[model samples]
Target: MPKLTFNIFPKEAHHGDESVWSNLIGGPSSFSLESRIFHSISICLMGISCFYIPYNLYAGLYVASFSAFIFGIFFFHQYYNSRFNARKHNNTVFGLIGLLIFGVNYFANSGIHGSTDLIWPAYLLLVFAITPYRQHLKWLTGYLVFFIIVHGLEFYYPELVKYPFLEGEGQFVDRISTFPIPLVVVYITIKFIRQSYDREKKAAEERAIAVEISKQQILIQKQQLEDSNSEKNKLMSIMSHDLRTPLINIQSYLELLNASEVDDEERPVLERALLTSTNNAVEMLSSLLHWSKSQLEGPSVHLAEINLLRSLQVTLDMETAHAAKKEIIVSYQIPADIIVKADLDMLQLVVRNLIANAVKFTPKGGLIHVIGEVLAQECKITVTDNGSGIPVDKQDKIFSIKAEPAIG
Candidate 1:
């Protein structure tokens, strides 16, 4: 025996919304307007057909046509009102009204004595095609109940079924040969309309999220600019106060030296004082130049492969005069063959600043040591001094703008 497979519900149970069904049922406001216009035109056409069907002078046909015109006007108003109000609420009422009109018109024109009975089923089919998903079960149940009552009555009272009133029975049987076809078409249409609405909703949500992200990025950039401006203002204040004091003192000392009424012994002592002042002025000038160059255009370097040992030797030689004046001994422990690619001028500035700082802060007979080593893909250089070390509290601020020498 083949294995039994049980499906508790059809695959359609898992199926969701569809656009085609929504469009038929007037899901969107635009589609509802279109459907309303279509319905109005169909009713008008039917009224014209009634006017010419059997004889043009029939009062019943004229009355039916007039009824269609009134209903058409009603449909137009419902379309606009539903659109103006919310679509969901109006569409529900619109579908209900359409069903009511179809049923009433069928009974009015093809009452017990009419000749066009086949028209009722066709009108019933139109309702099934366009009714909203929510109204499906109601439409089907009502149709089944009506069909049973009409056929039962016809069987009981055969005289009540007149010539045109029962004229289209054969056509009704032929049309309904494919019993479940309309139901399938309606289901597919509903599923399609729902999917379309879901896709549009998702795309709108994504666009909103992207806009929010862009706004946050702009805010972050604005904050960074404000911080930079604050830093620049603080640096300018320090430059103005610190640089002006030293220059003023040098000028005062020079003016005093210009007077020519001094003894030889006093002159020697004054000359020594002048020399010390000149040295202090030079130190201040050097600091200003270094700081200005670093600020104005950053450090310029010519990158090339250079021997680390040779570079250190050259740096020590350049600082020999300054080191001797301070009684500082500079030494290096670097491998001779260790080479690295770097800008010579930049490395020299780094080495000079470290060594000079050491000499400035060191006491007499203090020693300075330079060390270098090659590591994977990079090189490390360190300058150590046996002098007064920087205080722990000031270490974090050493590379900050607060530690920069005054400029102007």
Candidate 2:
């Protein structure tokens, strides 16, 4: 079956209240504040003049009617320039037009007693609203001087001022008709100014928020750098002290080998001691080199599947001499088929360090165990010793660099 649909409004009209309002305000972001203000005020003045031009003619003031007609033409054309011609409102002829027309309209349409007096301040406000701030004082002073001179000229030369309105009744009628122009002028100007102020305030707040976020990120980066530097200092202190111990052991063994009274059986023991010292030095140096690399390039992991027993065998063999020195029974059991995925360098480093620590702290003839277990989701390799272990309270600090208590 075919269905029919109907839309009441045109697709363009469906753009909603904001879109319509934006067009009224010269498409929001497209127009400058001055341009939009000029356009808005022009529309308002054109409307006011439409009513006054007819009203003035009907009231028998031909001079005021002609003045309104002139103003209507000016507002319409200037509105055209602001909306379509100029990118921003820079017209100053409005002020000159006001001065010229109002000057003639003043004398012809009952001088100081006419509606021109009511419209003067409103026109000045419109001029100030569109013009630059630096020109405000100049315009204000010029308008003030013009007002005083024109009023003074009429006051001294009474014959120059004409009376179009007859008496109090005519004056009252004139005031009523002329009042709305200034009222609408003040309203439009103040409204646009307030809206502009609120927008500037919101933009300022967003800039402040962005600056604050950037500062916080910079602070975080600074703290990380400080922590890294602190760790580097701690590592150097530990390495400088630890690295000397194995070197001293090797030096003493070499000195004994050079002695004349060295026995045949003692040679084997000395060689074993030398091997232990060499292994310790190699492992420690490897750890130091890895630490230096991490500081320079940051950390990286390369994961791959590897046989657990095959990986640990070389490391275990290196530790055999150290174990023999204390007569510590070091044993490990892992199924040959126990495969795990890991970064091989990082894995070997961790295991070598654990076994070294075990051999360091364990008492004479202590049993140190290295065991590997495949759990439901993961693999666990543990190196443990049957020596006085860390106290429960101190145990948690083992992996923490800041408050790491001594092992022995």
Maximum-TM-score candidate: 2
| Maximum-lDDT candidate | 2
Clashing residue pairs for model 2: none
lDDT of 1 by residue, 272-308 (tens): 7567656655664565456545544433455799887
lDDT of 1 at 331: 81
* Residue 330, candidate 2: alpha-carbon lDDT: 87
Q: What is the per-residue lDDT of model 2 for residues 279-302, given as tens digits with 9 covering 90 to 100? A: 767876776577656744655687
What lDDT score belongs to each candidate, Candidate 1 first? 0.55, 0.78
Give the runs in model 2 whose Cα sits over 4 Å from its true position. Answer: 1-13, 24-30, 87-90, 159-170, 236-242, 276-408
TM-score of 1: 0.41
Clashes of 1: 15
